[model samples]
Every structure is written in C-alpha cells, then in structure tokens.
Target: MSVSGHLATITSAEENAFIFDSVANGNNAWFGLSDAETEGTFTWVTGELLDYTNWFTGEPNNDAILGEDFGEFKADGFWNDLPSAAKASYLVEYSTSVPTPPGIMLLMIALTCLILQRKRIIFKTE
Candidate 1:
C-alpha cells in the first residue's frame, strides 16, 4: 500500500519481523491503529490498506476498562490492544514528497549561490 507522512503501516510479515527486531526494547509501543470511529474496525492513521496484522492471540479484544481501541505493537512481534491515552513509543513514517519548509529552501539556495561564486573565482585565478 502507498503509505506516506504518517505512522507506519506495516504491510508484510518480513517488515513486521524486521521492525520487532529493530525495536525489541521490552517496551510497549503504539503503531497508530485504532477503531475509535467504529468498534472492531482498526485502521492505520495514514489510511493505508490494512494488508497485514500481528495481533497477539485473543488480543485487540477491546477488553480494557475504558475500551481497547488503540493498537500497541509490542517488542515480541505481537500486537496488543490499548487505549489512545496509554503511554508508549510511536513510529512515524515521513514522506519524501513533503516539501522543504520555505525558510530552509531559501537558505539552501543562498548557500548554493555562494558556493558557485567561489568556484568561479577559483577557476578564473587558475
């Protein structure tokens, strides 16, 4: 699925295992799947296709006292249900299409002009 600029939408078993291996810090984490809109209908925050899942057995049970709508992809390559307010580490997916901020873009252009001018002077002296 074409996911960008949002929380990770892990779409394959290989990716899931890789992520778990990278972050096996023994801490619960949230991957931003929630059924806040409709019960039992978990969707990624980025709206990417729900093509894969690693749910821990009997989990996403929505069994929390307040309700378990949020998803916590644990360190053990399994997913569990939690509430949105629960504390955990989060993963974000950045998009290359996200444009540079105007200020940064301007700074880059100015730097490029200065470098070119320096090169021209060096070449003339040689």
Candidate 2:
C-alpha cells in the first residue's frame, strides 16, 4: 500500500532529542529529508521550509557510487543519506480536521431542542 503524510523533520534540538529518544533509539527509520529532487539541498516531504537539519558529520555526502539520496534515521539518532532502495522502517503522520467535543455537544443539544419543538407543534396541530 502507498504511505502518506510528511516525513518527520527536526526543527530544533528538543525535537531531535525527543525523536531520537522515543523513536530512533533502537530502530532505523525513513524520515522526510531527501535530496531526490535536488542534488545537495534537502527538503521535507511536507513542503515546509527547511529550517533545521541534524545531519551526521560528512553525511549527505551524496556518494555518487552509492547513489544515496534519501534521509534515514540511524539507531544512533544521527541522520544519513541512503539509497531509496535501502530497507528501513518508516514513520507516518496524519493531520485531521475534527470538531471539538464541546462543539459536538452543542450540536446535539440544538438538535434535541429542535426535535422537541417540532413534536410540540405537531401535537398542537393534531
């Protein structure tokens, strides 16, 4: 199946630490950074501005021999560029627009009141 959602891009040290500690501690995963579009510049899948990066030293070396272009989160929490064919776990994020609980409750109350008023009108007419 095709996966959706933007890749996780580290914007700050805190974010990096959190992701490293929580997600990257023991697993290698595919993150959002990639130079597949351009040679040197990396961009997140979300299309957000490239405000932060945490590349390991000498990473994204774009080793022409290896043909590394996709970003990978190593077990050490540092990032490196690997070939797109590299096998690794991946993370997917989703954004949803949903009504708040309060809003749902208010809508329910309004519907109840409208139903009661309609019943009363029907009874009077009968």
Candidate 3:
C-alpha cells in the first residue's frame, strides 16, 4: 500500500541529533522547514508549530541574490536556508499523526524494550 509521509520537522535537539546520526550521515539533507511563502516566515511542511530551531551561526541569511528559502541540515548538524531545487538528500518522517511530545520519549523507549523481548502472553481469557 502507498503510505503518506512528510518531510521531517525537527522540534528538539535530540530529534535533530537522531536524524543526523540516523540518516544525515554528515551530509546535507533537506527537512520540513521553509519560508517560501513569506520572506522570513519559516514553517514546517507538516503544519507543526515553529518552536525549535537549530540554525547555524548567522545562517538563514536568506541570500538576496540566490533566494534561499528551504531549510537543510548542514554537515555540522545545524540548519541553513537554501533555495528550492537544490540537489540534496532529504528525510521523511512517517508519524502519520501529530508528532509526539518529547516528554513521552522515555515511555516509548520502555515500551520498545518490552516489544523487543518478544515475550508471548502466558495467559488469555475471553
């Protein structure tokens, strides 16, 4: 089946680091950030609140000549603005719903460990 996914919208340092280590591979990759509509109004493609940012020093500097508007993760794990059509790797987040709050990360981890154990149910009642 065809699944729908959106470009990654990073909201925390941990998420950014996860994306970097998991897929960025120290190379440039586009995420779900951009100011294409307004000159300086950046928003996530998934309609997430513009809460967290990891821009590199003096970055986004939306170049007047090149018209940089899209957000990309640089090699150093920081954000930068680039023009559309830039040939770079990209990440897609398959959340399929609102992004989860970071506060639930530990709970998710614990549940994942339980799943990995592959323990079968010892009792069942109907």
Query: Each prediction's TM-score against the native?
Result: 0.67, 0.72, 0.72
Q: Write the per-residue lDDT of candidate 2 for residues 1-126, one digit (tens) a residue.
A: 344456777777787788888877689899888888888888888787887777899987988888899988888888889998889997656566655688899999999999999999999999
27-113 per-residue lDDT for model 3 (tens digits): 998899999887889999978899899999998899978889999998889999998868898878774445677779889998988
Show model 1 residue runs off by greater than 4 Å.
1-4, 98-126
Cα displacement (Å) at residue 103, model 3: 36
Judged by TM-score relative to the true structure, which candidate is superior, 1 or 3?
Answer: 3
Candidate 1: tens digits of C-alpha lDDT, residues 7-115:
6678899978877877546667777688988788889887878978889998879975778898888878799888777788876666665568899999999999999
Window of ten residues with lowest summed lDDT in model 2: 1-10
- Candidate 3, which segments miss by more than 4 Å at Cα? 95-126
lDDT for every model? 0.81, 0.82, 0.86
Query: How much lDDT does candidate 2 score?
Result: 0.82
Output the lDDT of residue 45, model 1.
84
By summed lDDT, the worst window of 10 consecutive residues in model 1 runs over 1-10
> Candidate 1 — what's its lDDT?
0.81
